[model samples]
Target: MKREKVKHMSVKGGASLFALRIFVTCLAAAAWWECLFSVFPGMVVSRSWLYGAGLVLAVIIGGAVSCPRRKVAVPAVILAAALLCWRFFYVIQGAAAHLVNAYLAVHQERGFEVRFWEEGSLSAGTLAVGTAVLVCVPLLTILLLVIRWGRGKLVAVLILLLPVLAAILEGAFPSAWATWMLIVTGGCYLTAAGAGGRDMAGPAGAAWAGTAIAAVTLLVLGGVSVLAGRAADVIRLEEDGFYSQTRQAIQTGVVDNLNAVRLRMEGQDEEADDRPEEEEQLPREREEDRAEVAAKEAPSASDEQSETPGDSGAGTLPWDTEADGMTDLASVARFSPDGTAAVDVRLEEAPYGTVYYPLRWGGAYTGQSWEETSGEDGRDSLFLSWPEGLDRLEELCASWPSDTVEEAEKQIDRELTQKAVYDTEPGRTPTGEDFAEYFVFESERGFCVHFATAAVLMYRMMGYPARYVEGYAVPASAFSRQADGTYLAVADGTMGHAWCETFEDGEWTVREHTPASDGSASPGSETQTASDSALRHGQAGDQEKAGPGAMRIAGRAALLLAIVGCVIGAFFLQAAVRRKRRLRVLGGRNRTKAVEAIYGTIYDRSRTMGMKESSPLREETCRRMADMWDSIKEQEMRWLYQLVLESMFNEKRPSAREYRKAMDIYRKTGAEMYSRLRGWQRWKYKYIWCL
Candidate 1:
């Protein structure tokens, strides 16, 4: 009997201390809100005050109903409401809505993209912080639940590893590991929490096993990842150029074999050369007039006089004639009296004047600029030249309707302006022919080869002394006149473009129909950059105007949601705590049912106050109460109102004497008992989810 008395006394003392603690906590909470209000605008506003009042009244009524005569309920309800509202205010204005809106707004601005969190935004930092708080509250609540239930440390560990896990799977591996890791982590937490709920505290030995497994799994996964990464690197290197190198080596071997065969066959070439003269006699004799009436004299080392009038040499460069199948020039042309007679004949053989082969032309070794070097280690010579066939092209141009010629020429000119269409350097084929093959059909957008071939064909048809020139054409910028009036020019691959020189009136004249003089931008022309060209095509946006107004509204809405969520969360928790206390005091049978009724009443009040209370509230209750008060007016119950207001809004709760004085006025206010009871119950249920 004596021990029971001591225990009872201890309980009473503890209850009194609890009341004092609540009082102190109320004061501290109010002060915190006040401080926040000072920093942020509108802390003690009409809307907030109304909300806070409503929430506090609901909690009081719920507490009264749950523990009929317990005076402690009044303060408990008030304090809980205030705390919830405070938390909610910060969250809505600070976090969710604000963040979304800021992001939208920033995106609309030039140079204002959403940066990583570390790179702070001046206007949105506060809102971001608020959002951070919003996210943390739910996470913290979950953590608290985990801790209370004594779950496995997986939840804590995952929270800690969030950034690390995020970093690990950023670029590409997330799909592979993200879901698996999440499942593992969740399973661990659930198992631990379940164990705790069952009152079966997990053994320390189990922790060791978990750790061992985790370590081994991580190590195995890490090793596999490393190996895969290395293998990928190897594959990439092989793909880049290693395979090409092997193919080139095989090609080189084949070419060497061909060269060896040619060397061996060379001895028979002299005989072959001699036989042409004898065997060609019949055809030459029959077509004497046609063969003898050559279009141009034979080409010689002497520039001006290589054309030997009647001799015509019966020799030609492979590309000069209508493309012929004869790789052996002298043998093929020998049958024709002056080689000119073989033009139509050769056309039946190899018809393509130019052929293309893929090759690399620019890199570190070759220099970034195509004009810098011919090629590194002679590798650039392997590139495929875009086929520019001149013979076939001339045939087309010759047959072109006069009315369409100018327009066709203009279109071709545009093509020539492109870098891909023009050839600054010739790429040789496997046959070792340095000249790019040209055909009339392919050379419509022809560079120098096209122009030269066209000139040759036209000159032939018009009857003039014209032979294809294979030498490079240097730009005028590279030329300098010598004392003898001969011009010398720097001869580099870039300056080695093709063009034609026709022998007109005993002098060579240049003829080129390609577009504007290449890609070189004169120092005086700064506006000719690719950007400027795109601008002319109307692709650039205006940067001077403000971004769309929708972004601003979004930002504001984000801020508002965060505030509401946080506030509502706080209120729910307050109601939950009150219900728990009542259940403990009055016994679960009566208390639980009463608390439920109280919560329902509070919920209805919340709705009337226009405060949406989602299930599982994560907002502050006090702010909600304050917001509710603004929508009502009742002077008779002013004292109770003042007491609740002082408890929530003051830096500290009112003294007991002050509260008693206010209570006296409250009881005499003539408030209908049913209405007061309903209002109090409504406040409780409204925020019950916060628990």
Candidate 2:
């Protein structure tokens, strides 16, 4: 009668423990759902179903790995800690970079220049979340350790309440609070479920079952949320008229700019015709013969141009032409050091053509620096409307069989360099002489600017519209390959360069005439061709082209899948190995060890199958197993138990025949219990071992 009462009490306690675990798991799952929603609202868009399913799977896997019965919890805790540290370090580094940039901006006249690193700098909300994670991860680790080492309900409840309290206090911030709540509650539940005590066994199965149900429920809720969000978006777009008006305003502005450009170009042509031919043409023969001696006597044209401009604004544009303080020669004659990273460019959409870098254009040199020439004249001449001097250059370009802007640019570049020579010396040009004319006909050996200026003037003189440009240039050789096949080109102060562009097919295309002095290809030349081709082909077959945001989503999804797969694979593999080792012991020649292995397997299987209360099974092993068994199985279990006891304590070994009989009974009992379980129950039994 006493034994029966004790058994009843044990069963009741087990049921209560199971309920507690289920409650904790649910709380944890809810917290996780809330947190994810807060961090990435867009993740719950059209693909809410997928995101929901993924969330459910993540919860289940996290619960299982952290379950006290598994050995992986320690490693999982370590990994989580490492991830937190990495995030902390990343945030600190970004803040430092921002500070440096801010300081530099304050000192410089141009103010702050935005760089690529600043793009990913943490915002206020993200920083708040990161701080929370830093605090929570360590706290959770300590809680897990406490539960693993010393099990108590008070400690578990307190740990679980931390996140709950946080959630309530910051209830207005649902995502953040929910994330905290989920991480705290889930971590606490896992620690409790895995910590083996009197009622641990019964609750193990219940905890797993509750996790599955909770996952499905959350998935359904996520889908509903997605549908509602979509409906709201539709209503919002329909009600908002600002977007339509803004788009119309943009279109109107573009048309006005185009019209302005056309009127300006026409006025420039009229002005050019009115000016004398003598004023435009240089004294070519005299300049060539006197160039070398003129270098010593003439004042630097650069210095003369720099003197304050007259009211006419003949030497510079009406806009600020103050030199950015960089030497004028630096813009035309510099090269980036090999392997320096300058800029990153990505093509987020398809059907995109070659990339172009805009440099100085619609401007003429003031003998000192390049400046915009659009003053009282309505507009400067664009490439489409060339001056009469470009007739020969136009004929040369027309003779080439190029079908595209890129091909045409390439042909023009080759022809421009064929007649030019590169001069390495700085400060070699004679002052007061026409810089372009001297470089082309007299000097013939200046650097990039000289070559570029000559090319632009030559193209224009031959009736093909061209313009000189100057800015930092990144060559193909300086670019490094990225995993996505885009190239990262680095340019520094030394890479400041000058080149030209010609109008083709209604668009201005880059043309490089600078010789490869360092044996490096020009920017957008042969070196980038392979990478460009790869980008084109890579997009051809992608039916569902994604934007930058979608790509980020896809990358994160892939990472999550990888992590989940590894955890699941590890769990199953560990279980399989342990089972195989037990089987090997059962089939061994050592009769004593074999009998012990068989009895232990049977005992664990009984607890796992929930046939006996987990707590009592530890102390009253024989009695608990006997009461849970039927007549035949109970008798068999008692005999095996006694034989295992004799082998362990009395130094009396079981014979080979006895070991075989014990193995047969253990296998038979497990099979019978497994066959009676429902499909989901069987799955739970196979994956999670409470003992």
Please, what is the whole-model Cα lDDT of each candidate in the order they appear? Answer: 0.32, 0.45
TM-score of predicted model 2?
0.26
How much is the lDDT of residue 214 in candidate 2? 38
The TM-score between candidate 1 and the true structure equals 0.21
lDDT of 2 at 412: 57
Clash totals in order: 95, 18
What's each prediction's TM-score? 0.21, 0.26
- Worst lDDT run of 10 residues, candidate 2, spans 309-318
> Quick one: how many clashes does candidate 1 have?
95
lDDT of 2 by residue, 128-232 (tens): 344334433444344433333334546555655553453344321334345545645555465444434321133344335544543443444344444443233
What value does the lDDT take at residue 644 in candidate 2? 75
Q: Model 1, range 1-691, lDDT digits (tens) per residue?
A: 5336434543553344223222322222233233222222312233344234333432344333234354676466446645864866744444444434433332322223454222223234344334434443334334334533344456655653453343333211123343344434443343333322212122222222333333344444444444444233222222224543554455356643564477567865564345432222211111233222222121112233222211223233223222321122112211111232121111111101111110111111111011111222222222211123334434544553334323443433333332122232222222322122232322222244444434434443333333333322222222222233332222222322233223433333333433333321100101110111101101012211222233333334444554554565455346535634542332223332333333334434455446766541223442453344422223423433444444445634455455444333321211112133354443332234221
